[model samples]
Target chain A: MTYCVGLLLDAGMVLLSDTRTNAGLDNIATYRKMFTFEDAGERVITVLTAGSLSVTQTTIARLREAIEDDDATGETSIMLAPTMLKVAEIIGNTLASVREDIDHKMNATKVSVSASMIVAGQRAGGAMRMFLVYPEGNFIEATEDTPFLQIGEHKYGKPILDRVVKPSTSIEDAQKAVLLSMDSTLRSNLSVGMPLDLAVIERDACRVSSRRRIEAKDPDFARMSEAWSNALREGFSQIEL
Target chain B: MTYCVGLLLDAGMVLLSDTRTNAGLDNIATYRKMFTFEDAGERVITVLTAGSLSVTQTTIARLREAIEDDDATGETSIMLAPTMLKVAEIIGNTLASVREDIDHKMNATKVSVSASMIVAGQRAGGAMRMFLVYPEGNFIEATEDTPFLQIGEHKYGKPILDRVVKPSTSIEDAQKAVLLSMDSTLRSNLSVGMPLDLAVIERDACRVSSRRRIEAKDPDFARMSEAWSNALREGFSQIEL
Candidate 1:
C-alpha cells in the first residue's frame, strides 16, 4: 500500500510519493516509489508508482535498461520518446508486460499483481504534460477540468484537492496542496507511512527543477502538521450551534 | 455504494448517511440507508447501513416487521429489547442472517450480499453507546477514546476525525464534523451522492432526538459548502512560499 500524488498546474507538475511498503502489517519497509529520467537539455520524465512492489520494481528496471541501450528507439525507451504521450506509452507497455507476467504466477496462489503510475514531464519541443496510467495500460491526460491525479490510499486526501486545487494553481501552492494531501493520507492509513519524496518540475525547465526527501523529523513538515491540527481545531470551534 | 457515519458524544449521538445506491455506475438510484427504531422513553436505535443494498434493505424490513408485530416479544422485536446492546445484537444477527440467505441465492451470479452497520443510541437506564457491526454479526464498541464509528466511504472524511473530534465535542460541532466528512466523500467518489439523513440522539433523551434530511438544494449545507471552499482558498493563499 502507498499514497502517491501528482499535480499538473499551469506553473508545472508536482509529484510526491511515500517510501513505506508493507507485506502484511508486520513486514513494513521503506522503498522509494519514484523514478526520474533526465537527458539534461533533451527530456525530463518523472514517474510515481503505487501497487505491487515486484511489478513496479521490475517495470522500472526494464525501462532503465531500455534507456541505457545504445540502439534504443522511441518505442523502446521513455528517455528518447518524442512526446510525453509516447513516454507514457512506453511506461504503460512496460508496466502492463511486467504485471501480466507476475499476475499469471500470482494467480496460482490466489493473489493479484497490479500497479499504476502517474507519468509527468516534458520533451525538448513538446508541451509540459501529465498522465495517469492504469493497471491495464490505458492512460488519461490531466486537463483543466481536473488538474491532479492521485493513486493509492487516495480517499483520505482527496477532499483538499477537490476544495482548493485547480489548473491555475501556482507551483508553490501546488506543492503545498500535494504535501497536505499526503499528510492526511499518512495520518489515516497505516499502510502509507513517512519519509516522502517530493519533486517539482517547473514549466518548460525540461529537467527536475526541485527535489527534496522529507525524513520523519523534517522541520517544515512538522510545522505543517502542527498548523493543520491547529487549523482544524480552530475551524471546529468556530462552527455554530 | 453509500456513505454513513455515527458519532457518540456527551451532548448526543449524531448519525449521517447518504442516499445514493448503484448496482453499476449506469444503474444509479436513491435509497435511504438510515433506519430508526424507537419506543418513546424506553429505547432508541439508529442503524446506518453500507455495502450490499439488498442485504440492508431486507434486514431493515424484517426489523421493522418485528417492531410492528402484534405479538412482539423481546426475542422478536427491537422495540421490546431491554437494552441498546440487545437491540444491536438483534440487528447484527438479523443482518448476518439476511446476508447469508441472499449470498446463497446469489451464488451463481457472484454478487456479494454482505452489509455492515453503525448502531448508536441509548436505552432507558442504560448509558448511550455506539457499535460498528460487521457482516459476521460481531461488533465493536466506540469508546471515549474513539467516540465515532463510520460505515462505507469512511476514508474521505477520516482526517478531520483524527485531528478535531473527541467525546466531549458538542453536538453542533459533531454535526459539522460529519457534514464536512461527507462533503469530502461526495467530492471524491461518484458512487456516493445525496440527499443525506442526519440524526442526533441526546444522551439520556432515549428517543430519536433530532433528525434532518439535507436535500441537494438545502440552503444550510450549500452555505457550509461555500464557506469551506472559501476557507480552503484562503488557507492555501496564506501559506508562504
Candidate 2:
C-alpha cells in the first residue's frame, strides 16, 4: 500500500509519495513511487503511482523505454506528447495494457493487477495541468473546484486537504499542505511508511525546482510531525465540550 | 452507512453515533442508532449499532420484547444480565440470530443482512466494560491500550482517536473526543451524517450521567465544529513548512 498526493496550485504543482510497499504485515519493503522525466525547459513530468507494484513498475519501465527509443513517435512517449492530456493518455494506455496482461495471467488465482497514477507537470507552451489517471485508462483533470488528486490510503488524509487546498494556494503553502496531509496518513495507517519523496515544480518552469527525500529520522519532517501532534493536543484541550 | 464510536475511559464510557441510513445515495434517511437500558444505580447498558438497519432494528425490538416478557430470564434480557460481558453476549446472540434469519430470506438477492454493535455500560458492583460485538456473535473487549471502538465509516474518524484517546482519559474529554471524531467522519464521508446521539456513563453510577442529541442547528455542536476547524487552520499556519 502507499499514499501519494499531487496538488495543482496557482504557483506550481507539488507531488509527494510514501516509500512503503507491503503485501502483508510481515512482507513490507521500501519502494520509491515517484518517477520524473524532464527535457529541461521543454517539458517536465512527474508520475506518482499507487497499487500493484508489478504493474506500475512495468508501465513506468515501458514508458521510459519508449522515451529512449530512437524509433519512438510523439504518441509513444510522454515527453513528446503535444499536451498534458496527451501525456496522461500515453501513460494511461500503458498502465491499462500492462494491467490487462498481468490480470490475464493471474485470473486463475483470482488476483487483481491494477494501478492508478497522478500525472502532473508542464510543457513549454502549454498550460500547467494535473490529472488522476485511473486503472482502466480513463482520467480526469484536476479543476479549480478540486485542485488536488490523491491515490491510495487517501481518506485519512483528506479532511485537511478539503479544508485548506485551493487553486489559489501558493507553492510554499501547497508543499506544506501535502506534507501535513501525508503526516496524517502516516500516523493513522500502517500500510504507508517513511522515507517520503517530494517534488515541487514551479509554474511554467517546465522542470522540478525543488526535490526532497524525507527519511525516517529527518529532523525537519520529525519536527513537522511533532509540531502537528502537539498542536492537535493543544487544540483538543482548548475546544469547549 | 453510519458512524458510531464508544470509549472506555477511567471516568466511565462515552458513546456517540450518527443517524444516517441509505440503501443508495437517492434513498438516504435518518435513523437513530443508539439504544439504552438502565436500572438507575442497579445497572446501565447502552448499545451503539451500525450496518444493516433492518437487522439492528429487529434485534433491538426483540431484545425489548424479551425484557417485557413474563417468562424473561436473566440470560434473555440485557437488564437482568449478570455483568456487562453477559449483556454483550445476549445482544451478540440476538444480533447473530436475527442476521441469520434475515440473511436466509435475502439470500436470493444476495444482499447482506449483518450488523455490528458496541455494548458499553457498568453493572452495580462490576467494572466498566465495553465490547465490540460482531455480526457473527463473537466480540472483542476494548483493552487499555486500545480504549476506543468504532464501526461504519470508521477510518476517516480514527486518526484523532488513535492520537488522543487513552484508558486514563477523563469522561468529559472522552465525550469531546468522540464528537470531534464524528465531526471528522461527517466532513469526509457523505454516508455518515447528523443528528448525532451521545451518551456518557460515569463509573459505578450504573446510569447514563449525560446524554445529548445534537441536531444540525445545535448551537453547541456548531460552535464546537467551527472551533475545531479554526483550531486546525491555526495549527496548520503555525507549523513551519
Candidate 3:
C-alpha cells in the first residue's frame, strides 16, 4: 500500500515516495521511506522503498551502518561504491538479505516479507543512472526508451507517466509529471496517503540538487493539484465521443 | 485478463467489455464477455463478466438454459424474476454455486476457479439498477455516490471515471467516459485487448437501444482515442508545475 516513482531524464532524475504504511486497515502509520546518501559533489544516491516496512527499514538501516563503519569500502558501502551500478548492487543485496532474514523468521507463521526500491544517483565523472531493484537482489536500469520506474500501487498513476515522460524531458517538467502522477494515485487509493518526499538530482552534479517534503495541506501543492484536475476535466469535455 | 465496466446514470445505463481471454501470455483468444437478455419492451438485462472463463461461461449458459426452461419460475429464471434485485440475486446465486462446483472439481490440483459479474437492466415498471456480483453470491448495487462498477484490470482506467462519472451524467457523456476509461486500460494492459462490446439501454426502453462492437481497426474509435490522447498531452503541458 505504497506508491514511489523515479524518472531518469536527460537533464536529471526526479523521485517521489508516499509516507503511509499499514499493518492492516486499522493499524495505519506514517513512516519515511526515502533515504539519501551524499558525499556532496563526490557522490549522491537516493533510495525510495515500497512494500514491507520492516524489510525496507532494516535494509536502509544496514546500508547506513555500512557507510559509518570504520572499515567501510567501495564494496560494502553504497556511498563509497565505485559507480552508480555498484551502489545499486550493494543496496539490492542488502535488501534481499534483510528480506530473507525476516521471511525465514516469519516462515513458521506463514507470513511474508518483501520489498523493492528505486535507486537513482550518480558519481563524479560518471553517467547519471536510475535502477529498479527487485526483492531477489536483481535490478534493471532505466534507458532512453523507457526512462521511468515505479513500484507499489502504480497502475492508477501509470497512464499519465506513459504519456508525458521521456528521456529528453527537462528537470522541471519531470518534477511536475511525477507530482501529478502521485496526485492521481492519491485520489484513487486510500492506502497511499501524504505527506510525500521528493528529490531531484541534476545531471553530473553528484548531489541532490533539490529536496522537498509535501505535507498533506501544502498550499502550492494543493493549487497545482486543483489546476491539473480542472485541466483534465476541460480536456475530457472537449473530446468527441 | 479482462476489463468490463458498467455505469448507471439518470439518462440510462452503459456497459463495455473487452473480448480477450488468456490461459497465459502465449495462449490468448477472443471470447465475448458481454451477454444480453431481453423480453423486448418488457425487460432488458446485460451482464459483463471477468475472471475464470470456465465459471463465467458455464454460469451464463445455465442462466440462458433456465430462461428457456418450461418449468422456469421467478425463483429459477432471471427473466421471470419479479424485480431487478431478484434478478441480481438469481445471477449471484448461480454464479456462486457454479464457482463452488468448479472449485470442488479442481480441489485435488489446488487450482482456483472464481469469477465476478456486473449486472445492469430495467424491468417494465421498475427502476434501472446495476449490481456488482461477487464470487461468494453477494452483490452490491451502484448508487448515486458511486455510479459505476468495473472488474478486471480496473485500476489503470479508474481515475478518469472517479473524476467524470456521476448519477446525473448524460448517456452520451457516459458512453464517452467509459470508452475513454477503456482506452486508458488498453494502453496500460496487454491482457485487456480490442474488439470491445458496448451496449446502451435508455431509461424505460426495456431493451438495448444501441450496441456496437469496436474492432481493433475501427476508425471512429481510433479517432476518439487519438483525440483523447492529444487532449491529455495538451492538458499536461498547460498545467503549472
Candidate 4:
C-alpha cells in the first residue's frame, strides 16, 4: 500500500508520496516511489507511483530504458515527448503493458498486480500539466475546478485537501496543504509511513524547482503535524454541537 | 451505499446514520438506516446499519418478529437477553442469517448482498456496550482505547473521529464530533447523504435519552457544518509550511 498526492496550482505543481511498500503486514519495506526525468530547461517530468512494486518498478525501468534507447521517438520516451500530455501517454502505455504482463503471469496464482501514477511536468513553451494515469492506460488531467489528484490510501487525507486547496493557492501553501494531508494519512493509516518524497515544479521552469526527502523524524514535519493536530483539537473544542 | 457511526463515551453512546440508499448513481431513495428497540428503563438497543438494504431490512424485521413472538425467550429475543453482549449476539446471528439468505438468492447473478451493523445498548443491570456485528455472525466490541465504530463509506469521516473522540469526551462534544464527521462524509461522497438519524443514550439510562432526525435543511446542522468549514479554512491559512 502507498499514498501519493499531486496538486496543480496557479503557481506550479506540488507532489508528495510516502515510501512504505508492503506485501503484507510483516513484509514492509521502504522504497522510493517518486521518479524524476529532466533534460534541464527542455522538459521536466516527475512520476509518483502507487500499487504493486513489480508493476511500478518494471514500468519505470522500461521508461528509463526507452529514454536511453538510440531509436527512441516521441512516442517511445517520456523525455522526448513534445508535450506533457504525450509524456503522460507514454508513461500510461508503459504502466498498462507492465501491469498486463505481470497480471498474466500471476493469473493462475490468483494474485493481482496493478499500478497507477501521477504524472506532473512542464515542457518548454507548453502549458504546465498534471495527469493521473490509470492502470488500464487511460488518464485524466487536473483542471482549475479540481487542482489535486491522489492515489492509494487517499481517503484518510482527502478532506483536508478538499477544504484547503484551490487553483489560486500559493506554491508554498500548496506544499503545506499536501504535507498536512499526508500528516492526516500517516496518523490514520499504518500502511502509509514516512520518509516522504516531496517535489515542487514552478510554472514554466521546466525543471523541479525544489525537493525534499522528509524522513520519519524530520523535525519540521513533526512540528507542523503536532501544530496541526493541536489546532484541530482546539477548533473542535470550540465548535457548537 | 450508506454511512453509520457509533461512539461510546463516558456519558453514554452517540449514533448517526445517513438515510440515502442508492442502487446506482441514477437510482437513489431515502430510507432510515437506524432502528431502536426499547423496553424503556429496562433496556435500550440501537442498531445502525450499512450495506445491502435487503439484508439489513430483513434482519431488523426478524428481530422485531421474535421480540413480539409469544415463545420468544432469552435465546431468541434481544429484549429478553440477559446482557448487552447477548443482545449483540442475537442481532449478529439474525443479521448473518439474513445476509446469507439474500446472498444465496443472488448467488447465480454474483450480485453480492452483505450487510453489517453497529449495536449499542445497555440492559438494566448490565454495563453499557457497543458491538460492530460483521456479516459472518462475529462481532467486536468497542473498547475504551477505541470507542468508536463506523460502517460503509467510513474513510472520509474517520480522521475527525480519530482526532477528537475519546472515552472521556462529553456527550455534547461527542454529538458535535459525529455530526462534523458526517459533514465531511457528505462533502466527500454522494452515496452518503442527507436527513441523518442521530440517537443519544446517556449511561445507565436504559433508553434513548434524546434523538433527532436531522433533515437536509436543518438550520442548526447547516450552521454547524458551515462553521466547521470556515474554521478549518481559517486554521489552514494560519499554518506554516
- Per-residue CA lDDT of candidate 2, range B1-241, in tens? 8999999988889999999999999999999999999889999889999999889999999999989999888889888888778898999999999999999999999887789999998888899999999999999999898999998889888888988999999888898899999999999899999999999898889899989999999999989999999999899889898
lDDT tens per residue, model 4, A1-241: 8999999998899999999999889999999999999978889999999999999999999999999999999989888888888899999899999999999999999988899999999989999999999999999999999999999999988999999899999998999999999998998899999999999999989899999999989999998888888888888877887
Quote the positional error of residue B200 for candidate 4 in Å.
Answer: 0.6
Candidate 1 lDDT, A1-241, residue by residue in tens: 9999999988889999999998899999999999999987678999999998999999999999998999999889887787788889999988999999999999889899899999999988888899999998989988899999988888898888887788888888888888989888989888998899999998888999999999999999988877766766665566543
* TM per prediction: 0.97, 0.97, 0.98, 0.99
Q: What's the CA RMSD for each of the models? A: 1.5, 1.3, 1.0, 0.7
Clashing pairs in 1: none
Best by TM-score: 4
lDDT of 3 by residue, B1-241 (tens): 9999999999999999999999999999999999999999999999999999999999999999999999999999999999999999999999999999999999999999989999999999999999999999899999999999999999999999999899989988899999999999999999999999999999999999999999999998999999988988888888777
User: Per-residue alpha-carbon lDDT of model 2 for A1-241, expressed as tens digits?
Assistant: 8999999988889999999998879999999999999998899999999999999999999999999999888899898889888999999999999999999999999988789999998999999999999999999999889899999999889988988899998888788889989998998899999999999999899999999999999999889889989999999999998
Span of ten consecutive residues with least summed lDDT in model 3 chain A:
A232-241
Q: Over all chains combined, what TM-score does candidate 3 have?
A: 0.98
Clash number for each model: 0, 0, 0, 0
Docking class of 3: high
True-contact fraction in model 2 equals 0.69
Score residue B176 of candidate 4 by CA lDDT: 96
Ranking of predictions according to lDDT: 3, 4, 2, 1
Off by over 4 Å in 3: none
Tell me the spans in candidate 4 whose CA falls farther than 4 Å from its real position: none
| Position A5, candidate 4: lDDT | 99
- Docking tier of model 4: it is high
In TM-score terms, candidate 4 sits at 0.99
Question: How much is the lDDT of residue A136 in candidate 4?
Answer: 97
**DockQ of model 1, rounded to 2 decimals:** 0.62
What is the TM-score (0 to 1) of candidate 1? 0.97
